[model samples]
Target: MLHLQVFTFNPFSENTYLIYNDNQECWIVDPGMINEQECQELFSFIESHQLQPQAIINTHAHIDHILGVDVVAQRYNIPFYLHELEMPVLNNAANTARMFGFEYAGVQTKPGFLSEQHLLRLGNDPVTVLLVPGHSPGSIAFYYEKGDWVISGDALFAGSIGRTDLLLGDHPTLIHSIKTQLLPLPAQTAVHSGHGPSTTIGQELNSNPFLN
Candidate 1:
């Protein structure tokens, strides 16, 4: 079974996730730590569990979601994965943070772009990559079939959907992505988002205002 630990970090309260299995092999997603305390917290959890981080991934390159990508990737000496189309978004992260009155070092490491045609493997498990853009030009979500859960960056929230007012964001495209890519999943599948609380697919489908 896959195990997950969530650390709500940074001024943005972004949800960073560490996912691992019995093998102790793990992946870090959206490392949102921005200060010493937050970084130490994440490091402490990994060290305490003796987890071996295999990869670093970002569902999107928005400033709040990637504040600690550089630190985490460097510490684990792992490859950072993001969609190729998000390069522009990644490049603008620091500036965006500044506009928000937050200082971010920005992710300095080059990312290995996720491919729409491929499945990501962590040890023996397979993770499906969904190109659910519009929240950002290259926003994506990770779906684990066996676990029946999706790490949906800033896409679908508990009772809302990702905003389409940011750079390259489009309301229609975001809605379409959620409907066609996310809603099709099983009702019981858990939706793990980049911010706020977790919700099930069924709950969102039944009551999410934007979807309705």
Candidate 2:
């Protein structure tokens, strides 16, 4: 069975996920722990669970989603993974922090990138990459088909959808990706998003105003 620990961090309350399978391997997704205590809490959870994280992944490169990429990467000695187009956003996290009137670590950097790897080991359970880039230019969601759940960043939400007002955002593209990539999944498929609550594809299709 795959085990998960979700931490709501930062002012935005970005959801950072730690996933592990029965093998005691784990992966951290969107390490947005904006403060030192949050970071410690995150690491502490991993240690407490005896999880050995094998990979670090970001659903997108928005500042809120990636504020602690550098810290997590450095601490775990793992290569960070993000879509190719988020380089600009990754490079400007500090600027975003400044704009948000928050302090930045000043060491924010993009240390890695992702391609369609056959398997992403989240503690022995393999997750497949699904390119659902609608929230941002390079936004992508990861899916573990075997597990019947997806980590759907901002591209999707419980009842609303991601706003396309930011850089490299496009409404039409997001709609297309959602229709083609997400809705096609089994109706009962679970969607774990970056914020708010989790919902199933069927529930969204039946009730989401934005999706309709």
Candidate 3:
């Protein structure tokens, strides 16, 4: 079975994830660590568990979600993966950080593109990539069917939904993407969001005001 570990990081309280299998091979998802302390916390866990990081896979390129991407990728000598369409968002990271009054040195990692056409693998486990935009134009989610969970980056939240006021954000598109790509999952499927606490699809389906 694949195991997931979540770390709440940065001023944004973004949830960073580590998905690993029994073999200790892991993938770091949306590393949001913004300071040395946060970065050390992430590294300490990996070292303590002897986890071997395979890659840095992101659901989108939002500034808060990628603060530590370069650091982790460089530390582990791993490649970074992001959706091809998110390049514009990634390119604008520094400006976005500045706008939010955060100090950022900008990301130097080159990303490999992810598409719905492909499945990401860690050992024998396969992860389905769901293209769900509107939070950012290239927003995506990672679904691990066997694990009955989806890592939804700033897409679907517990009681609310992703804010559609940012650059390229569209409320209508985000809602449609949620209904089409996320809501159809098994009602019991776990939803690991980018921010805030986690919730199940059934719970969101019943209580999420944005959906109703």
What lDDT tens digits, residue by residue, belong to model 2 across residues 1-212? 78667899998988999888887878899988878999999999889988887778888888788877778878887778787877777776678778888767543454577764446666456778777766788888888788789889999999988878877788999998888888998998899999988999999999999877
Better of 1 and 3 by TM-score: 3
lDDT value for candidate 3?
Answer: 0.94
* Candidate 3: count of backbone clashes, pairs at least 3 residues apart or interchain: 0
Local distance difference test scores for all models: 0.91, 0.82, 0.94
Candidate 3, 9-105: lDDT as tens digits = 9888999999999999999999999889999999999999999999999999999999999999889999999899899899988889889986676
Candidate 2 TM-score to native = 0.93
Cα lDDT of model 1 by residue, 5-93, tens digit: 89999877899999999999999999988889999999999999999999998899999888888888889999999999899999998
Instruction: Estimate the overall C-alpha local distance difference test score of candidate 1.
Output: 0.91
Please give the lDDT score at residue 83 for candidate 3: 94
Position 164, candidate 3: lDDT: 88
True-structure lDDT of candidate 2: 0.82
| Candidate 2 positional error at 39, Å | 1.2
